[model samples]
Target: MKTIIYCWLFLFIISFNLYSIKISVGEADISLRLTDTDFTIDNYNFDPPIKETYSVEWEAIDNMTYIKFNYTGQAMGEKIARGEKRYLVLFSK
Candidate 1:
């Protein structure tokens, strides 16, 4: 049916819109993905071959954006155990 074909086409287009950006920082390779409401970051280290994912939520208020995340992993030859951080960014335009 034409309806079934349209549904499949819509799903195919939506899947391709989701993308990620990858970058290397020091000994870690990080991938970041952003959607309408939230974003996620995946960090992978080559030396110890460890991978960790950090999921966080963001909200925009006027010209400022807020982000908060809680993560636990290894860092700088030592274990992070547990840590959390909050960030506020202001945009100028």
Candidate 2:
């Protein structure tokens, strides 16, 4: 029973790690992370900086995957020099 429990725990950890993605630019103070169902971005280049996380919706089409999410943070609008934006991200195996 103990062995079975340990095995399951190990598998869970491995599965979680397999589906997680992280990207960082050297000395840019910008990073992005995507998990199984969530997406996050951290950018410290703005006047007030920006760090927000939004739920991700994904769809599989042909050999590619599409990820969509909305950002309603301080970095939005014309005053900040960035207007309403839409991003199309594609992920392929």
Candidate 3:
């Protein structure tokens, strides 16, 4: 019946949304170190570090927007050279 189909579709949509919990992350200033030549490198293997997994959060205090992400990833893949910087990002499902 129509009622059963509607219920099933609604449940399906809800479950799908729950699985992802998409969040958008953006900021003006983010920095990361440089590669090679630098004493600090990912795992010290001379390879690019893997992108880290992060939990996203946001806050607003008197017109200042603050976004924070907790990294659950290894620092092995994220290394820049001296006096350099890079933006780190990740989307979770």
Candidate 4:
């Protein structure tokens, strides 16, 4: 009985690790964690500096539209000068 319970627990842990995501940049860090205890986000931001700029985007992806919103602790605006750093962490509806 003990062996059966242990085996089931191990399998459950493996399944939880598959649907998790973590995003960050070199100096900037961001975390979007959902605390349902059903899904896990385990450092899926395997890369740094994930810049998804819509500088000249003609339309949205999958027929989606993004309206105005704000992201605290993040730089969310167009460039005024030369290179520095920008980070946006919100895509609201």
Backbone N/Cα/C clashes per model: 0, 0, 12, 1
Model 2 residue 43 distance off true place after TM-score fit, in angstroms: 2.6
Q: What lDDT does model 4 reach?
A: 0.24
Task: Compose the digit string of candidate 4's lDDT tens values, residues 17-59.
Answer: 6422243323333332233222111222333212222121112
Pick by lDDT: which candidate is best? 1
Ranking by lDDT: 1, 2, 3, 4
Instruction: Summarize candidate 3's per-residue lDDT along 1-93 as a digit string, tens digits.
Output: 000000011111233343222222221122221111212112223244433344334445675533343443344444232121222222222
lDDT of 2 by residue, 1-93 (tens): 000000010111234455433322222332233445544455565566664444455556786545544443444533222222223443344
Model 4 weakest 10-residue run by lDDT: 1-10
Which residue pairs does candidate 2 place in steric collision? Answer: none
TM-score, per-candidate, Cα-based: 0.40, 0.37, 0.26, 0.19
Which lDDT tens digits does candidate 1 get at residues 39-86?
Answer: 333344345533343445565788666655555455455654555555
Give the total clashing residue pairs for model 2. Answer: 0
RMSD of each: 14.8, 14.0, 18.0, 17.8
Model 1 shows how many backbone clashes?
A: 0
Q: Cα lDDT for residue 60, model 3?
A: 52
What lDDT does candidate 1 reach at residue 35? 58
Instruction: Between candidates 2 and 3, name the one with more favorable TM-score.
Output: 2
Assess candidate 3 and give its TM-score to the true structure: 0.26
Arrange candidates by TM-score, descending: 1, 2, 3, 4
Worst 10 residues of 3 by lDDT: 1-10
